[model samples]
Target: MSAPALERAQVQHRTVRVLALGQVLGGVAFGATVSLGALLAADISGEESLSGFATASVTLGAALCAIPLARLAAARGRRVALTLGNLFALVGIAIVITAAAMRVFPLLLVGVVLIGAGNAGNLQSRFAATDLAESAHRGRDLGVVVWATTVGGVLGPLLLTPGEALGRVVGMPPLTGAYLFSIVAQTAALALYLIALRPDPLLLAQRLARDDARVALPGADVDRPVAARYAMLAVAASHVVMASVMAMTPVHLQHLAHAGHAGHGGATEAVTLLVGITIALHVLGMYGLSPVFGWLADRWGRVRVVLLGQAVLATSLLIASTWPGERMAVVAALFLLGLGWSASTVSGAALLTESTPLAPRPRRQGMSDTLMTASAAVGAVLAGLVLGQWGYGVLALTGLALVALTTLLSPLGRR
Candidate 1:
């Protein structure tokens, strides 16, 4: 290989390493907050109905912040954008801790939104992995960074007991313990990005573009808006389908238990255990084998993998809707759902990175994420309504319809 190529490869390797580490640490905070946010919201509000808003705020925050963060990255660098995001989260966690002590529900909501802003940064890091990557390996690099989140995602909740103990030692409320942990984690991520993410990947890529004008880099000269538009649609649609179904799954299981279905004779503890196991398996599916999917995306092509993902999602919805009362079926459905989400997300992300030009890519990426998060937020809200009014089966059916529509309208099908 030429010297420039070798140098670029080394830089790419170093950049991905730092980004992956950040994902792991950031994932911890996100996992803890997601697991506890709804329960805490319900407790604070003294109203079960308000519990959904906690998660909704996070989603909305991500959508709201995506544009500004992308613009910042566009103007300055990924390091600045990412660090600011983590800082926002750190401050948000501090507020949450304070609100918990004060028993202030609205204040908690404010903090959670900022935490979501941090999530937007975390999401953008995956794209950063691709900025300096070779086209042939883009999927693999993106997948590796995404898979790193699995570590913290799985381990965060397990630390809840210790976190709570730490909270008590510091004279904070027990429930606020997780947020305290989040503060430390967010701070570490912020510092790492600020210090280690030097010679920012995006900026470096821009330089490479200028130095090697004759050399073709992925999406560096693409001027086709229609192609990028299609890619964005695929990303957003898949996210909406995944978020909607996932949001209401636990509630659906609980309703089945109460209705005396397969779990009719089960105790509260038994039901809770079942629900926990199912969710765990689902998360495992989401993160596990992501590298494998990335490989497939490279080998089989991104569009093909995205189509396969749509099929998997459709099958999962079918099984879930048809056998809502069956415990094993529900578990299988959720696992498949996670796998489908991974496939679509990785493939769509790579496709988007490859379809847009470098100059406009940052803002375009931000717009894609904004649309994705916003669509998911809408889907999640509608999911609750669907589950409450009709039933879990109908909700699954609705998701299936969405998948079908999205797939048909996708460039994959049109081409």
Candidate 2:
């Protein structure tokens, strides 16, 4: 409203945009690693079952370090934490390269774990963006950061096709080359973060809050015990459910194909194309409309949007459970899962940002993410066991129940 206020708002906008670009690049590297890591592990180990463990190891590492890493960011600031994250990634890439050269399975898992630690930091970038934004625009800022990830996520898999060829040229496995690309991307991300992400938005917000007491007017007094706890719970629940369904979808689809259920209607290439399309659509649902969801959270109310997300998730799971063998049905289910995830994730993040003061944001964000990732790891591990014994239908039903439970708890969330 005032001239000073208008200038501050402009600065915040610029900061969020710069951070969003860094996040996009980071997300691209992350997307590539996630999309190709399992296949790469399978190639190196020559066992499909072991690949799951390798992939799970990365998530496990992230789960273990999520809170601690966030605390580091909280204490030392984003630049240090992000640089450390990139360093971890570099080390992980080196390990993977060595594993490929020597053909070692255990070493490869260790490498993935390092990469996972880096991922935990990358996940926190959106929160950092929120620290630079006005309370009302928190969701939109977070969404922009998230939207950036889609480009890299889409490009990551496509790179794999060329990455494999490059691998042959370089005398390494195709997937090894992919890891090499991760190294370069992560290094560039780190440089961008350190050079461009200056003055630390959270720190800036904190200073601004101190100078102008009124800055804490909207949703800023959320440091109350009850609100803080509820916000943390919502963030954790949203992340866990999203991670759980995503982890299981591919495995379930693979099972159907193996059972001669899905591919029965088509050739292997067609099935492959169907799977690719499903993943692309799933990604689209996750990141495409995130800004809209954020806008909704700002306008309609955060908790209400989160509840709607949970309800949609439950419905999607129920539908999937009823038609586990149908490809189209599963695709639709995944689309809903992604949409629900987008809503919950964006809204939950905005809620967390609004509820916590600048001082405790990094720590709380870290703790919340750690719990979320841990829950997701548990869900992924359990999904494997559940799918192995009871089949895809049972897994879907189980997820439905979890979503329902989350929905029931939604009332506790901040307004």
Candidate 3:
């Protein structure tokens, strides 16, 4: 490559790194909220069922706001839309804090909803990273952002320990302190984004597109339909399956213990620990090795990687269904679930980023994320119903069916 070409490549690499760091912080905030939200809700409401509602509310809110916020980003710019998301998160944290102090369930729900909206913004950060990258590195850059998320995600749960202690000192419930910490994390995330994400990747991509136009190759000017939309659907399906299966695991475990399967102990505490570990491992699977998946997508093909991920997820669900009463079996299943999510998410995001021009990047990103979160919400709701009425077996089979559907659609993915 020529000197100018090399320099451009270097700039793109640097831009991707910066965006990845920002994504890490954002992921930390998000991970903290997800890890602690259920416990916090249960503590606040004094009802286990309310935890389901709280989780659903957050996912539902994100789903509802995703496309709209994307449109806002498209019309205005990412900086404004992202800043707005941070502000919403700030408000949501306040509501949760107030709800804790007042012991109001409804108010807490509102807070979760706002936090979900904030998540919609966080999810778009990958698209921003991709906008600044060359096609060859697009998946890799997106994966780097996903990998960055692991740092915050791992630390978020650890914060729970300190947060719980702080809650005691402040005369608030321990779970309330988790939300407070989330506020601090989110505030820092906002600052990082504001300071580092200036100029906006979408705008940069637009400029690149214009530059490419001046030195256009054959077929370069023709608008290629973005493969990201289809990839987004696959990503959403994986998330929904993961959330649905993971959500009901604790309940299923308790039933097993009741039937004299797990072992001797207070089933509740064991179940709680199991749930926490499962979530942490699940998160690990989702973020860890994401870069590898992204690289594979760019190298081998996005659709093939996505199809492989779906197959992995289907296998995990099948395992979970076959041995519902075994703790060890369940843990292994969840681990696979996490891994499948990581692969699909990383690859799917990269596909989305490559599929669109800068002008529509943010809006498309937001739309994809919204669909992703919405599917998870639907899965959560359905999981609750299936687990309550039909049994874990039925849910697993249904998840398998979805995976098959995703596989069938895999051929539609971008090269």
Candidate 4:
């Protein structure tokens, strides 16, 4: 490789390392919310029905923050933007702790939203990985950052018992313990972003892309805005499909297990264990093997990988729809669903970064993240309703339709 090329590759390597560590820290917060956000809301609100709002608030927070964060990155550089995101998370988790003490519902909502803002940062970090990536390895590097989340995501909930014990000893509110651990984790993430992200990847990449102005690839003359938008849609649609399907899996598993174990002893525990394990496996599918897909995307091409993702999703949903009541079938389908989402999202993001030039990237990328979180927020609400009314089988079919639509859109992203 040329000297300049080697330098860029080295910087990209460091950037990915810092991003991966930050994600592990951020993922702790991400996983913590899944286990407690709703419960805390329900406890503080004194309304079980309103528990869902806790999760919603986080989603809304991420959606609301995406555009602003992107704009900030565009203006100030990624280090500044990412630091702000981590700061929001730190403050947000602190508020959650305070809200628990004060028994205030609204405060808790606000806090979770801020935590969601941090998650929005985590989501953006994937794109940040590509900011300096050579086109050939962009997918692999992005996949590494994406995979790092699996660690904190898994470890966060397991900390609940120990976190709660530590909280109880310190005289914290019942569920506030997790938030306490979250505060430490998020604080570390903030510090990591503030310290390690070095020299700002986005700004550096912009300069480099400007420096190497002569390099051109397939379809370089395509309208920048059109290509960018298509890439955004590909990323956003793939995300919503994953979010919508995964959101309802627990409820589906619960109902199926309940029916199957109506007369069984310890049925509640059995059902919980089943749902937990299945979801964990699904999470594994989403992130564990991402590097493999990333390599495939780099070798096989982006749009083709996107199409492959859709096929995986189609097969997953078909399995789900055909055998919704079967325990093993559902578990397998959920895992495949996660795998498909990983493939689509990873490749779609790579496409997005390359399709839009550096100058316009932050704006388009911001819009992409916003659309992802916003659509996911809406899709989750709708998925719950769909599951309640028509059942898991039909919900799977609906997700299938979404995958098919994304499949059709994938061709547009082709060079």
Write one digit per residue (lDDT tens) for candidate 3, span 1-415: 6543454456567667666776667766766566666656666777555555666767887898889878877766677677788888888878877887788888988998998898788777777666556677778888888888877776665555566668778786545665666777788878877786656756555555566554221222333464666877888888888877776665565566555635566554444445556666667777888889989988987777888788789889988889876777887887888888888887887676667655666666777788888878877766767776778777777888778878887766753
Question: Predictions ranked by TM-score, top down?
Answer: 1, 2, 3, 4
In candidate 2, residue 218 scores what lDDT? 59
Compared with the true structure, all predictions reach lDDT values of 0.79, 0.72, 0.72, 0.78
lDDT of each residue in 326-392, candidate 2, tens digit only: 9889989888888888888888888877777677777778877777777766776666567667777
lDDT of 2 at 153: 60
lDDT of 1 by residue, 234-347 (tens): 888888887777766665665556566453563433434455566666766677767788889899888788888899899999999999888899989988988888888888
Provide the global lDDT of candidate 2 against the true structure. Answer: 0.72
CA shift of 351, model 4, Å: 0.9
lDDT of 3 at 355: 70
Which candidate ranks first by TM-score, i.e. highest? 1
lDDT tens readout by residue for model 4, 222-333: 3456556777777777777777777666656656777888978765555446655676677777888788888988999888888888888889999999999899999899
Give the least accurate 10-residue stretch of model 1, judged by summed lDDT.
263-272
Estimate the TM-score of every prediction: 0.89, 0.88, 0.87, 0.86
Candidate 1 positional error at 287, Å: 2.1
Total backbone collisions for each predicted model: 0, 0, 1, 0
